[model samples]
Target: MKIDGSTVLVTGANRGIGRALVSAFLARGARRVHAAARNPAALEPVVAEAPDRVLPLALDLTVPATIDAAAQAASDVTLLVNNAGTHAVGHLLDMDLGAVEDVMRTNCLGTLRVLRAFVPVLERNGGGAVANVISIGAFGGTPSLGGYPASKAALHLMTQAVRADLAPRGIAVHAVFPGPVDTDMLDYVARNEPAFGDFPRAPVAEVAAAVLDGLEAGEEDIFPDAFAAEVGRVWRADPKAVERRLSGIT
Candidate 1:
């Protein structure tokens, strides 16, 4: 549960939230942090920051071989951050079935594959923690980005079930529900769905820092930013209300 002196592995470590997480690991005194991305070459800049502590690993959640290779290479991982995910921007009704499938494959099945490959590594290390970067939209969805939220909704449930299943193994699973993050992706989403433009966007650095804080504190459900925490409170009190609010059905 502790970050200091722990060996960490973060997926999707190329840029945005993932990149910040890599830095957070170093700042929080992780003994080693394997920064894994589809394109390991993109991780070079992050790995260079702390060449001694940061290791670049080639990992594509959707690619089983890459996931297996990363797990084997980062066998010492004490913490796993399932941050790699894909989003399909559109109304659920309008989105292509294939696009939805891709989202599910990447966000849900991909994460499962990585978890399956890495659980043994964690067990071998005696015990460890897993942090899954889900989204607030899991409880509901916006008019746009339907497939993205649907994928996250599945992951949200998976994280919960995994937490219960893994707790007995001395492996803690933390679910992170972040709201809109200030990234290129956010801008793209906004362009696709103007409604999302109204929501506040959290900085990537702050979100990453909050994630580490929650992990170190052993929080089961982490809302890393103000907007997410606010939504989390309501969702905790009345999930249906949050659902209705997002659905514009209230």
Candidate 2:
């Protein structure tokens, strides 16, 4: 789908990759951008910069009420960016069940919910695209991240399924697998394990630009960053080898 002049809805747009996505879309000439986050106030800076193009809305992916409310507010959105996610760091067996559930609900189920709610909007607006921000964790195994990796794996599968289901409707579904970026999630992980400092990190703006480029290219799966692209190459060659490498990292 063309990036310019499209109505876009970006979840978790208050900060990190989500915030970068909002700015990238605006820079790419989107007609409007809905900056959705748990606290709408967090989007003040983005709104301040582009008062006429950016709309701030309260959106908590884990909360159905908030999701529904945000969907209603962004009823004209043609592009949906599922960037909201939760991370639980620990061994799956030792971690809290609630934490695991939160990750799955936010990263997996929440994405689907937003898509379902926005399909009609996309259909009305000539069927645009939905970008689901997945991770290398979707294919790789890292014991330290616990259920977070498993949740991303579920999202990866969901992305494929959504593409198959939505293709007939002309709604393009693109899955993004980004390796360790210099986001707070990685920062927290790095604090726990200094070795993470050695892992390659991409700037959030670069990742966002890559995502838009992939969307414009009509790609089904996007590994926007170089590190993620390298990981994808290895994954395709040998899934087991990739798993073994991630196992060593954790």
Candidate 3:
């Protein structure tokens, strides 16, 4: 929906794309923005930028208590942005089970938890929108990212299901599939897997701006960057071929 005059809540707002989203929302004239991060102290810079409009919130998606607390604290939120996620790069079979679980918990179940907690809030506030920051990896398996793609794939499906379920309630559900973004998360992956070193990355501000633009345009599935748009077009043209290509990327 519209960003202006809306109360928004964004998770993982400490840095990277999340931080950019918070700024974009403010720039678009959101009445208030709840910037949630695992560490509230890390949100100081964002809050300082707009002390009256930004509220720093402590939220750890994996922690149900923190999710509940954030929901309670941000009752006026009309737009919810599920942007917190983790990447444990490795082969699924060889990676530590704990790491896989962490990825699933934060990316899938944790996002679901936030949605569940916020449904009533949205309903009470006359139903708004939910924007989930998923990835192009959701379309196919990336051997290097392992369970990270699997978790996102699950989230993509969940976003579709939620969209259908929430339509009658007036709450819009948008799924964002962004390709490599210039963020710390991608930096970490590039450091560990040289294969990603040459992948095209979109600026964080551009991606965030495109996402909001998509929402304003009522797009259910948003490919926010050039790389993502190209990959999405190819994947839709031939899913199997794209899968095979990704499989060969090492």
Q: Model 1 RMSD to the real structure?
A: 1.5
TM values, all candidates: 0.97, 0.97, 0.99
lDDT of 2 by residue, 1-250 (tens): 8889889999989889999999999999999999998998888997887999999999887778887878778889989999988897877888898988888888888877887788888888788889999999888778888788889999999889988988999899999999888899899888876778789889999999999999999988899899999989999999998899887777
Best candidate according to TM-score? 3
In candidate 3, residue 214 scores what lDDT?
98
Locate the minimum summed-lDDT window of 10 residues in model 3: 241-250
> For residues 1-250, what per-residue lDDT tens digits would candidate 1 score against the true structure?
8899999999999998999999998998999999999998898899889999999999987789999999889999989999988876876786688888898999999999999999999999998999999999898875667688779999999998988899899999999999889977788778877777887899999999999989988889999999999989999899989988777711
Among residues 3 or more apart in sequence or in different chains, the pairs in candidate 3 whose N, CA or C atoms overlap within 3 Å are none
lDDT of each: 0.90, 0.88, 0.94
- Clash count, predicted structure 2: 0
Give me candidate 1's TM-score against the actual structure. 0.97
The residue ranges of model 1 lying beyond 4 angstroms of the native Cα positions read none
Candidate 3 stretches with Cα past 4 Å from truth are none
Error of 2 at 77 (Å): 0.8
Q: Is candidate 2 or 3 superior in TM-score? A: 3
lDDT of 3 by residue, 1-250 (tens): 8899999999999999999999999999999999999999999999998999999999998899999999999999999999999998989888898999999999999999999999999999999999999999998898889789899999999999999999999999999999999999999999999999999989999999999999899999999999999889999899997788777777
TM-score of 2: 0.97
